[model samples]
Target: MRDLHSNRPLVWSLFAAFALVTLYMLGVRTLVPPDEGRYAEMAREMFVTGDWVTTRLNGIKYFEKPPLQTWMNALSFSLFGVGEWQARLWTGLCGIGGVFITAYAGSRVFGQRVGLYAGLVLGSCFYWVACSQIDSLDMGLSGMMTIVLCALLLGQREGASARENRNWMLLCWAAMALSVLSKGLIGLMLPGGILVSYTLLTLQWRLWTRLHLVKGLLLFLAVAAPWFILVGLRNPEQPAFFFIHEHWDRFFKTEHHREQVWYVFFVLTAVGMVPWLGMLAQSLWLGAKRAPGVDPRAFRPRLMALVWAVFIIAFFTKSNSKLPGYILPVFPALALLTAIYLDAGSRLARVISAALTALVGAALLATVPFMPGMAGRSTEVALYQGYQPWVLVAGFVSLVGGALALLYARQMKRDLFVLVLAVTGFATTQIMIAGFEPIGKARAGTAMLPAIEAQLAPGTPIYAVGVYEQSMTFYLRRTVTLVAYTDEFSFGLQQQPELAIPTVPQFVERWMADAAAGRRNLAFMREDIYTALQAQGVPLRVVARDARRMVVANDVKQK
Candidate 1:
């Protein structure tokens, strides 16, 4: 394989292409339900209320996770305005930047081509690409973990200057600190645990001295502990909720109601890595093979990476709680392994990878025709109809890229083969993901916002009766009163009792009082809730309706 380092243009091109695909998708789709809208709203509230200490959801105390992501997101809003793309910019940048960082660290540790391949594998990996395009803490968490892992690898290299070693170790500690800020303590726990286990496995007690524990610990404490300390001080209940309930209880008990079968992550990581899973296994097997080495004290980067991946999967698997993103920290290590494997220039590996690409391309193409049939709802099917052409474009790009990869492998052009698949990754992400805008639109409840907004005059209190559309709170640019509806926000609402209207009767009484006081009120609820409201003979008039939600107003004349 030709050295990718010689061609600055090619490197820049890859970065540009990946960035464009990821950034373009940020604005194309409305923030989807639950996660996207939830995080974005959290950031929005932080920006609105100027309360960076205790993170809030729907104007209530939200203490499940730390505020690092929310802080970055709030910073984004301050810089770019309160738009979708702006909210996502931090996560998108982290994903793109993580690719380069992994490549840089890989090159420093391995060689140039291996580094390029590392970036290619990570940037284009199915799950990484998907995570990068969304506004989630996972990518941020993944990126930060990559930094910490890479720094540890780079610092522990065989023969670096003492100054260089200390600097790298310090950076590693700092990145771990930021990692804590990114998601929660797992950021430190996962990687730190990996380091301890790897050290024990290698029997390299001397590696401990290289860690620069004194300054590193101080640096980590300085960056990571402040927010927790401050937020806990401000909201006394938060320390218990975040440290105990969120981390410990979430791991030990399924009290949060997110328990899953033990093998879920195994399946998710296997499917998530997709075309690269075979290479990942191959890399691991290769790592486990003992090389003929006289120096038993030698440090092993692959061993470190393998430990990182294994520890994350094992720790998460042992926990009572699980999510798809919990396994994201494993990809960096897998990408590193694949890069090393690719660096060895295995024609057979390239051939197999290309074949997998072809299979995946075919599968993507195959899904296009049946998309409408797949969706049970007409609105969703209509979204599929509108989104079908772009899916075909994605399929065509992926197919062509795969076919080109096969030809490159046939001709022994491994560089072109990898490059083709990489571009296909970028294209698949851009087309297929951005193409889901219609679906996002449908689920986003944006269509119903206009009518809902019209009925909402200045200072008109809006009620989310028996339903909470996440994006609506952000769209309305104010917190909606929850009338007998608190799902995820129940914890926060519990902490702040005044923030919600906990019962249907309470809402009715409040609505009647507000109506009698000559204050117009509007409500958005599910169709079932609207039916129930009608059956109860609620005075609200239906102003607008969508497939799932209805907007009702006290004054029919406004509609």
Candidate 2:
């Protein structure tokens, strides 16, 4: 209440610094397995195949999730030329945009100081920064949800001009639609659920009349429904698999192999906050003690934000589906709440922030030796050992930075204290990502592409037996024939049965046919599968070998 507005220059300067790290530096890294590689290759395939309506992974109908992210990435590839950076541009932009959106809305709801600090909290949060540059759907979803959260905050202000209210609510509705496109109905449903809980807590049903439900619903359907309808028309099974199976089943059942203990989300939030975690907890404690808004009877934006954060954590706690990134929607609200508390210059918060910063430094330093444990295989441990030096450097820098932040906190230099931790955390995270190349090397099929390319003869059928690598098709620039292997693409293969060989015997017969014709063929398989094929007299010569997989070809005369 006492001149807590941000100094524009300071806010802009810090924000600019954060952008430089998130955009250019983070963009330079390799895409990791499963998610990053999968999504990047999807966009790549989208660009190459020019079949945007029916999403395909390795040329199979991939209807597991919606395609807004892929569409954006595909467009990015068109303009920038496909590379790791171009592939990740959407998520980076979203993270950068999320900061500005939170700042703008936080200032409107609380004060400029809260706005600036909230941006810092989110910008420095590991989850926000890490996911932002990774080319994941969650970053896009979190970005859109941040907008919706901001719009809800501004639109729900105790007193606002009718036009302002209408515009804000419309933006909120439109964001929900965008979220649906970004991920699924949870985009709309998550926000809607939070709103219902907020209304119940605040006893503020009056805001509903002003929500323009009819117009908003029409707008949402107009923006989000067309894709659903069109995709369903084009692929009949998609409607059931997507709406019922993907959304609900993925959440309620352990179909994705992602089930974890209910407390897993709590762990994510704790680690996700990192240097800011202590400050956030202290802020939340203080914020909860009083009405978190302009008036006692008026709605508490902080409580709403707190409720927003808690609802998300509690919402998925019991659900069988879980991932570290799913809890990200709550960060913006928590950032706002933390910012408001910090703006009051809570002395204990500064002390705790200082102590926590030191603890983070110690933890990071301790993490150096454990780096090898992150590697999947014994051979990869040496590669992970090579990464240890970078981790050590980041740890040392963070230890020093944490000490400095502790000093700044003691001096009550709020800005510098926050800035120090933010920069250190950002650097440490970037270091870890940069050092992950060795691991990515083992996981990505990228290097194998070149070796496989050198051996290819024209019309030489390439088969992936007992494995489906999502990134292989993108890197190879063509889909490999799936021989008895369809993991995530099982549903897609069901719709287009010709795309797969369902059994080992079937693949053996096909390979023999190709071999007898004196036509060379390529195959990639897990080591065990390759061994089994060899035992079955399928006749394969090793072309390339990695710790987890091998590339081979039919025993044939070299050209």
Per-residue lDDT of candidate 2, residues 205-300 (tens digit)? 876887879988998999999988998898888898888888888878887899898799999998888767777777667556655345666767
Q: Tens digit of lDDT per residue, candidate 1, span 1-559? A: 4666669897888778777877777787789877888889999999988988988888888887788889999999998899898878888888888888899989898778888889998888888888887888898898888899899889987777798899999999999999999888888898779988998888888999899999999999999999888887888888777788788898999877878898998898876775566566788876665445726787888788888888999999999888889898898888888888876746777777777877777887898888888776775678788888888888778778877887998888767777877777666766778888878877778888777776666888888988888887887788888888877777788777788888888888888787777789988877877777778877778877766677887654553
Q: Estimate each model's TM-score.
A: 0.96, 0.96
The Cα error of candidate 2 at residue 4, in Å, is 11
The lDDT for every candidate, in the order shown, is 0.83, 0.82
Model 1 TM: 0.96
Candidate 2 regions off by >4 Å? 1-7, 292-294
The window of 10 residues in a row where model 1 has the poorest summed lDDT is 286-295
CA shift of 423, model 1, Å: 1.1
Cα distance off (Å), candidate 1, residue 81: 0.9
